[model samples]
Target: MDTTLQDPLVGRLLDGRYRVDARVAVGGMATVYRAVDTRLDRVLALKVMHPDLATDAAFVERFMREAKSVARLAHPNVVGVFDQGADGAYVYLAMEYVAGCTLRDVLRERGALPPRAAFDVLEPVLAALGAAHRAGFVHRDMKPENVLIGDDGRVKVADFGLVRAVGSATDTTGAVLGTVSYLAPEQIEHGTADTRADVYACGVVLYEMLTGAKPHSGDTPAQVLYRHLNTDVPAPSAVVPGLPAELDELVACATARDPEARPYDAVALLALAREARAALSEEQLDAVPPQARAQVRSGAEDRTSVIPRVLPLPVEHTSRLPAPPDPGPAPGRGPVTVHRRTAFLVVAAVLLSLGLGTGVWYINSGQFTRVPAVLGQTEAQATQRLADAGLDVGTTERAYSDVYERGTVMAVDPAPGERIRGNGTVTLTLSRGPRIVKVPNLKGTPLEEAKKALAAEGLAPGVITYAFSRSVAQGAVIGSDPEPGTERSPDSAVALQVSRGAPIEVPDLTGESVPDATATLQEAGLKVVVAAERIHSPEDAGTVAAQSLAEGSRAAKGDTITLTVSKGPRMVAVPDVVGMKTDEARGELEAAGFRVKVEKTFPFLGDTVTGQSVEGGTNAPEGSAVTITIKGL
Candidate 1:
């Protein structure tokens, strides 16, 4: 059925910008579609949150967060997010459209892949993840389905909807969000995840690619989850026999039950994968195991096996003779006369030819040869050994090792005793010694620069925490996990404590009373200093008029928060109106910013002014009252 036609979103324009054309894929959280940007006229993938999920505020936030998070990452192998918006019920993110199948598709068709092919796919995946991990984001859901293998062979990691900042608490409230097959043990047990979880998923992916099957499987998701938490992931070699030991070790390192035993991040795992690839011989990398689906016939013997066999036909001979001569002879003598040796010889020759052809086919194409053992040998020595055995070195790579000396071979592909063609190539992995590194002192270094320094020293910048520092500047490193002078493996994460300068946020004290504002500022780790002289202002008397630091501005502990108090409105002088007309006095007093009230001493009196309050011409508070007594007739 063409489900895309039934989908309402198909053929509709989303946000009036993206013209959704056809549905590409559907996932638990959202449905992906092929769309064109009407404004930009570029093809892209539109990931629209499911209507049900969109109604949930938390899910919508997480969906939009995926867009924002992926957009910040500018790596080539990471899928790009161009825009995020909503059109009616459809909230969608327009992402870069990769036109090809997924790693899962390849596995479904080909079963297990050769080591080289598996590495080819896995290395790019790890590269994309390494970028995300370094950027301090974890791809909480990493599976073959999220790995997009473009038609042009470019690999991209997608679907960061579950991504969260490192050190975030796990959600034990509900079922985990990732596929059961790829979920890390911690993710299954505690619902917690970190960069190492992604590493574990990639390791499981690598295992799947090498063996053409998952490490653990069950009838239900719960059972699978239980296995992830309880069982150790068996090595790929266990299923695909003859897989390189380095591969087993790589899988073991990645899928370790304990998160701490795994690589700190994808970048570290990538290094190990490259090292494993280097140690394998070409024959080992391309070796076709029994578990792989037989898709193509590689040799002439396979071609011959498909040809129809020619069956021998039943033979009958009729002998014609002069009628009476044979009648007198015995019946046994008559049959002996008809025997033809020439015909029998021809039949025998054809059968002999068929037998010889089958033998030639087997000798020319069906013969197998064993890969010579070449462990612990130099690259030149390994190459010469393979050449003496009619094989060639395919690829050479260096890997860190504690047992093998530097420049000597550490491992070989086909496991030193696997069967391969004589003309095949052997990949040699040379030793680079142990990967030991010291934690560099990053104290006093800027946070961003400290991260770069750690990366340069073959270390990863782990979780960042902030603290108030008296001597160190803000955004500078206060210390690190494992501290300085500690020796650790390469790509180990070093947690950094960065100085937050001083713990202070200036309080908004515009209208607060002097006492209240002072207490608030003091409580916020600041010293309050009130100016001695009061300033005249419109604000209420004794309220704060101004502050040294602006509202919400950052400040250091014990930093003084200078304040200017308000003394209320300025006072105005009252005008003198003694012996003046009552109306004139009232007008003069009112004009001098004082309210006037008349006090008549006699009824029906003349409009002459009488005694006035405050003796007139005296200063009183602004907007104060003045009283004057008028004389009667």
Candidate 2:
């Protein structure tokens, strides 16, 4: 699609005002050329849409829509669109031309960038995204190909017009747009666009910059979309060991399945990028080779050695045991003072002989084997090493940890091979890693406030569901999954339900006729169902008389309402109660599902069962209670 001309648009005027120069670059949909606005005497980049695309009415409409949308955005990092028009068969956009290679070019030349350099590249991308997001625009097609690195090392994001085309899906069936590898889960699942979607693509670009490879790639775009939907991106640390944990968290947060699960937008991402870069630099210095450290200086003022000092043990009464109680001479030895004195010497000689014999035996048999040190080693390695040292391995316990690799021993008691006797249990304290508590309930809280709460607890944001809620105002969270106050492990997902708008009320027309009622309900945006019933009044015969739930109640769309229709008036023999008091008989009749009609009691029937008509039980339409004529005799 490269257009060459000697006297070509090179100095030739366009639209009788702007003069075009040499072609700069060619792309699938447009050709960029260096041009000058003759009237303003300023340099500009002329981007002419492919003539083929211009022929498609639909593409032209979409391109114009994009142009209109991008024209509203004003951002420093975003390449601005100055003018858009059609001349004869060609459509062109005059834009600000950045005079540098693209991020793709840098990546191709450098293979994999250093951590800091990658951060440098992504920082500006995030900035541009942040600005677009703030301006109510999402850069849907964010990829390295659309990022231009200027000769001044400034990175400017191009192709802002592409967002409108991609975000607004023309096909209702949810087609994938832009580069599939960087598509967010929601974008693929619902054809929904949001700020996080761009954040996700930028994250993939950052990953590519660091690893010299895209985290998600496949043979086809569809395959890539599927992977983005189903697969979790492995942490950068996993691929390149020693990568900063902060960087990994940043990437993971951006690529989270839920849109609200990511950092608020690219604005926050840029801030996090700076912090990650600093932290990584500090870490890299500490991880330098020992030889390098030694060559530096004697007292290099080490910042990493912040661990507190501990005191050494001193030797004192090292092997002492509790003294045994001495026993006095027996009572039977007291025959007299003289007899006692003689008995004392004989007893003393016996004690002295016993003590001398015990001392010789104690020294001969009390040697103990020292416990061997086996802490901080893998289970298999530690077990084998312990066995080789004539020591029996003890039980093992596993726990999640960030410090020790999984299955490594955290510590051992009676450490290694300390010997007392034969069989002994060495209490091993395995590294379970760090403790993690789940995210707490954040519903009803502001998003920023909830995020702060989650950050304090070491948990991350998860899915954010939006729905219209009358109770909860718009933008306010209605509820959250894992519910509020539920404990979760660190990095646990925090789902939120945000309010969309006010809820709509459903009309109650349960008593209306079927045809008339259906029309009325539909007009009021309510669904209806009719059920048959038999009633006594013309108002209740073969017509909807009652509603399942009361009318004027608040309900959302698609809520079902049942209608009770009449099957004409039904009759049955009235229950007989000759003498029972009015209140007592009324309770019994009502409990039996019959409507009660009470008349003033006659003088003789204050509280007695005197007579009966229709007996105690009879078939009825379930609402007939008879009157009692008491004391007619």
lDDT of each: 0.77, 0.64
lDDT of 2 by residue, 484-593 (tens): 66776688778888776575565666446767877776665568776645445324566766666677666555556777776644655445555576677767667766
Candidate 1, superposed: residue stretches over 4 Å from native: 161-178, 295-633
**Top candidate, metric lDDT:** 1
lDDT by residue for model 1 (32-94), tens: 987767566456889887887678777777667767877999998988998898887888888
Worst 10 residues of 2 by lDDT: 304-313
Question: What TM-score does model 2 achieve against the real structure?
Answer: 0.41
Sum up the clashes in candidate 2.
Answer: 20
Tell me how far the alpha carbon of residue 205 in candidate 1 is from the true structure, in angstroms, after superposition: 0.6
Question: Backbone collision count in every prediction?
Answer: 8, 20
